[model samples]
Target: MKRLARALFASVFLSVMLAALLSLAPVLSKHGSGSLPVFRVEQPMHLTEGTLVDFLSRQSMNMRLHHVEWERNSLTLDLSTTRLTNERYREMYLLIQRTLTQTDNVESVRLTVYDASPATPAPLMTVRATRGDLRKSPAVQQESERSYQQYLERFFEVKRY
Candidate 1:
């Protein structure tokens, strides 16, 4: 009777362990199989109008930019997203790069997409500065702001008779 009870207890424990392992399988697979490199904004990207929030939502698949760390000439962004496919991730990366490149404070936008696997840890993209790239000088920043204001004024097309 004692031996039988011990066997039954051991069987119950094994079943419970198996159940737990099975439940965790999907989560582990996702984490291991499709992990992607996260992007970081390395400068204070003074967004024009509502573009900043819009950009983040679209790029990170509605994930909010939780934290921002500012350095001397750079800013690091902590962004979160649910789960993105390779194509979606690439599209988001390009969109950010394009937007940043359009800004004066952004000298260059580098996108480093991490591999989906640990053995192949490499960035998928590395955008470099193009020629005639506006330097992040104070004058350039001021000029850019002035230009944006002027553009907005023109865009509104308010007439003075």
Candidate 2:
């Protein structure tokens, strides 16, 4: 009876240790430097999110992008700020369109910016553009105009002077 109990206890302890090690393996590689993850090819969404975050952090215009989601052929970025400006919108839209449109995997990109001004409820402004539309000159300009209009409508609410 003693021998059987000892064997059982040893096996259980070993199994638990092995399970813990296996679970922690993936997390161990994520905490290091700016070095690109070796497993990026297997997970395209992670690759995209990491790249965008790095790019935004390096840019002059401050952007607080809270969430990034990749669904099917689309990537969505959720950005929030106390205030937003015209130049910020232009910079973000151009950067995303220029960078992601060239990639083979993504077809559409949507940027959802939330205005977190203190007086009123947060207003949302979404701008969506396809890869083909971004590639065309007229379509790109149109999309930019539309995005700017949407931003003005949502936050500024341009009243006729």
Candidate 3:
């Protein structure tokens, strides 16, 4: 009876230890720098939410919308796509610039899209948009506010001025 109990205890202990070691294998084998490199967007342009999301979806890309500030007329999106070719990535940036330029509400668009794929190896894209200065003219302000209000009504349920 003693011998059997000892053997069972030994087997259980060994199994537990083996499981623990296997679980920690990833942590132990990780030798490279754990930090990811940051890439800056070269030239950013203004863009609309609809246009941005449409382009991404058309390309079958994934993205996360981080922050949207209508007052500042800016938005920040994180590119979550993994299959972007270098050329395609550049093309996307150009598309954004062109689209923003075409939009009536965008006063000036500047972008600095970049990727940090070589380290931590994840692709990221960021966009920032600024609305044109309509404060100078009451008519322009009213028109812009109306358009912005329409956008809000279409996309959000919250009441906004």
lDDT winner: 2
Error of 3 at 93 (Å): 5.1
Q: Give all TM-scores, in the order shown.
A: 0.29, 0.48, 0.28
Measured by TM-score, the strongest candidate is 2
Q: Give the per-residue lDDT of model 1 (tens digit) for 59-159.
A: 53343344543333333444334443544444543444454554455433333233444564434332232213323223323445444323222322212
lDDT tens digits by residue: candidate 2, 13-112: 9999999999997677666554676666633333365565664455454657777787786777776667667766666656465545445677777777
For each candidate in the order shown, give its overall lDDT on alpha carbons.
0.45, 0.61, 0.43
Consecutive 10-residue window with the lowest summed lDDT within model 1: 152-161
User: Candidate 2: where is the Cα deviation over 4 Å?
Assistant: 1-61, 119-121, 138-161
Candidate 3 residue lDDT tens string, 56-105: 34433233223233323443343434444544444544434444444445
Candidate 2 lDDT at 11 equals 100
Ranking by lDDT: 2, 1, 3
Clashing pairs in 1: 37-114, 42-74, 42-75, 43-75
Error of 1 at 4 (Å): 99
Candidate 3 lands at a TM-score of: 0.28
